[model samples]
Target chain A: MDEFELIKKITPSSLSHREVEIGIGDDAAVYESKAGYEEIVCVDTMVDGVHFLSSHSSPGDIGYKALAVNISDIAAMGGYPKFYLVSLAIPSGWNESAIETMYEEMNKLAKLYKMDLIGGDTVSTNGPLVITVTVIGEIEKGKVCLRSHAQPGDVVFVTGELGSSSAGLALLLEKISTKDEGLAQYLIERHKRPKPQIEAGLICSHYERVALNDISDGLANELNEIAVASRVSIDIYQNMIPKHAELHKLHTEWEKFVLFGGEDFELVGTISSQDWERFAQECADHQVSVTQIGQVSQESDIKVFLLSGQNRVPLEKKGYQHFK
Target chain B: MDEFELIKKITPSSLSHREVEIGIGDDAAVYESKAGYEEIVCVDTMVDGVHFLSSHSSPGDIGYKALAVNISDIAAMGGYPKFYLVSLAIPSGWNESAIETMYEEMNKLAKLYKMDLIGGDTVSTNGPLVITVTVIGEIEKGKVCLRSHAQPGDVVFVTGELGSSSAGLALLLEKISTKDEGLAQYLIERHKRPKPQIEAGLICSHYERVALNDISDGLANELNEIAVASRVSIDIYQNMIPKHAELHKLHTEWEKFVLFGGEDFELVGTISSQDWERFAQECADHQVSVTQIGQVSQESDIKVFLLSGQNRVPLEKKGYQHFK
Candidate 1:
């Protein structure tokens, strides 16, 4: 099919948002921004092999994960993503069905996030497939979260578990044994389809004296960021970090996964100690699992301590580095 | 440098916009949307070898053109190009100087257009360098232009000239005669550094009976798009199209460059004959060159008439298609 024909066939009619005045089929998409709110914009790119492998992931998962990662950015900022633009570059010989499936999956996630797929460009590539998604979101004025707001004596908390995604990646590469099919599948799913802590982030934003960030890199790196940006030291207990039970079953060096692996898509934040009890109660009421792992200090350095027998080592501040 | 370090170094210290509440370094950038206006979003991508070659273009032109093309989209919509997000995928072995040079060039253009380089992600690619720019613009509520709004009797107009970009590409590729060095350089600059017709589009938007589009895919393809979208036929006088005189001197197939070449970044719009005099005066006041090339007709077919001695042929509609 020609570009116009393919676009018409794939574009969903009437993306269910009154604010979206124009979606596709225009030089640019138009939308109305809600009153008394600040608009948040975030963009991310996923290149084949570097971000995902077609050999291990389905077309839908790739599409879903691409949007999901950007959503995690908005979630971290305490905003609700409302519209997105996707630029896709596909290599030759790729079947049309796969491209259609990718868009279908993105549409499903867009509806789930209450966002409209506004507009973007599609072109052919001779290299790896590249997908870039730019998300526009909004939050109530003065209610947005930032990494540079953690104060000394703030209690550090993390939502959900970490390390599973890294473990999942290892399993996919066959670097770790996959004898237990159930454990292998669980880890792989964690790596492929991550759930962004959107609700938890929104809930955390309502409280005063809180700073938030999403754990795209491992928890250690995120904590360090909060420390550096806010000019406060962070000290976390290694035993307090939540990790999937399957991670230990598959990898002996699971600590590396928990501390240095990337792509968890969980929220890490700091709340004042006085508000910890209230925050914990609210998390419980919302059915979100949040664990207080550490505390912010006046010292200008981050430290991770382990209490486990024979493994009581201070963790290094290293995380995933794309370039050497 | 690592991704984080590079981001910190490349990110501007502050963008001088009161609406920009937060710039780079956050998970997402934040800005206040002006009241009584609609936000317009556009995105475009450039791939190495497909869009331009490092051998033929400078690093700075590559960056400038990447953003320039997206600006053309906003210009077509008669919007103010205010903010932009750029996602870049750079292959290994690319030094920091080249990346910095690219950003410097983009910032120069951004300053010219009064746009802020808000936020985006960068990743290391094992493949070719890929740059995707997402532009956020604004237009007065209900004042945005559309291709489907052309009236049957409206006269078609185009800003600046066409075929220069394609002819420029031909010179760069060494496919055409290079004896005229100055002409070759001018055409190459047209290809490398296209100026988006932002002023002309904004002037045209003031009129009630006007429809607009940017000529990115040559004159013929843009005319066909307007015809199909507005459900009217377009009849054009081939001799009326504004082309670089040097293009005629370079090649025998000059008509193909004017009709089928893409990447002109000039505005194409239709204005009612009643408003033609006033519109032309306004364009002249703005120092923007515009030419009347065609008229919309009742018949549902686009025809281009070329009058030559014993040779009158209706032009075929063809443009640059990424995939055959």
Candidate 2:
């Protein structure tokens, strides 16, 4: 399909919002910010073979995951996603039906997040398929969370279990067959559609002296980022990490996945030691389990320890880094 | 270079603005909008071998053009460019120094436009090089321009010359050895660095009845877009198109380049008949020449007539379409 035809076929006739002055048909999308709120913006790109393989991911899943990653960025900052612009670079060989399915899935996710799909460009590419999404969000003034706000004595907490997505990816890559179909499906789905911890971030943002960020580049890397940005150190106990039971049963070194595997999209944050109890109670009310995994320190070194009967053994591994 | 190290090297240490609450090295960038102003957002992508070939275009040119195209979108809406996020997908074999040069060129453009280089993603791609830029701008309430605001009897005008970039691309691809060194460099530069018509757009936006859009596609295509969106027809004299003099001298059928060529990033706008003289005077004062090219008509069909001895011949061709 041509650019205009594809846009006309996919563009929604109605994406009603009070702040939207102009929508998809304009040169640029225009919207007003509500009073007393600041805007938070984030962008992410997903490539065909590098980010996902079509053999493993459906068009729907690919579209959903592309938008989901940006949603995770906004969720990491404790903001409400308001609008997004998507630029698709489609290769010539791609089918129009698959393109339609992709937009359908993208629209479904936008509706779920209450976000309007604004304006963007769709161009033909000579290489692999690439989708880039720019998400615009809003948060109350001074309420947006930051990675550099972790205090020296803050208690580091992580929402949800870690390493499941990485474990799921392993299962997909190894082509492992399991008798437990349910377990296999669950793990694969974890890799396919990881949920962004928006509620947990929102709850954490309300508390004083809180630092928040999502675990997109693995747990250790995110913690190190928080440590480096906040100018503090972090110490975590290996036993404190919440790993999936199925993952542990399958792999002996599941902790490696938990610590170094990325794309979990789970929120790892730091709250002041004095406010930990109150934050935990609020998190419980929100149905988000909070686990204390580490503590912020005055020294600027990130250290992970395995607690033996009497002594602590240092477990050294940095988080996953792209282009390494 | 690793992603973090590259980001660290490229990111500006100090990008302080009153509206920018948080800048780079964050989960999401945050900024506050000025009261009574709305936000305008646009995104565009450039892919290797599709948008440009590295053999012909330098890394700096590719980076500058990538950001410049998005700037043109903001300029089309008459908005003040404030910030942009860039996502780079670098293939495995690319040089690190070239990547650094790309970022440096991008930074130079951002500085020139008074925009901040905010947070974005850098991932390794197994395919070709890709760069996606998302820009955010601000305009006063109800001051943003739209393509659908054209009215019947409005005068259609375009800023600067048309088809130079397309003509430039033709020369670059053919490797035509021209002894006129100045002419060759001028056309090549036109393709490499398109200046967004920000000042002209801002001046035109002050008028009460204005409809504006950038001519990224050819004049014929953009006029057709305005016609379709505003539900009005447009008619122009074939001789009125502002083709580059050198191009006209080089190709006997140079009108085709001016009519159907893309990538000319000039502004094509409509102003009511009564406001035409005033707009023209203001444009002249700003050192921008405005040429009256066409008029919006009551009928909903676009037509360009070449006056041949008082006999008008119709020009057939719907302009360039990506898939076609």
What are the candidates' individual DockQ scores? 0.82, 0.81
The native-contact fraction of candidate 2 is 0.77
- Over 4 Å off, model 1: A300-316, A321-324, B300-316, B321-324
* Residue range A153-174, candidate 1, lDDT tens digits: 8999999998888888888888
DockQ-derived CAPRI band for the predicted complex in model 2? high
A90-122 in candidate 2: lDDT tens per residue?
888889899889889888888877888898778
- TM-score of B-chain for each predicted structure, in order: 0.95, 0.94
Cα lDDT tens digits, model 2, B262-308, are 78889998999999999999999889878998787776555544443
lDDT values, one for every candidate: 0.85, 0.83
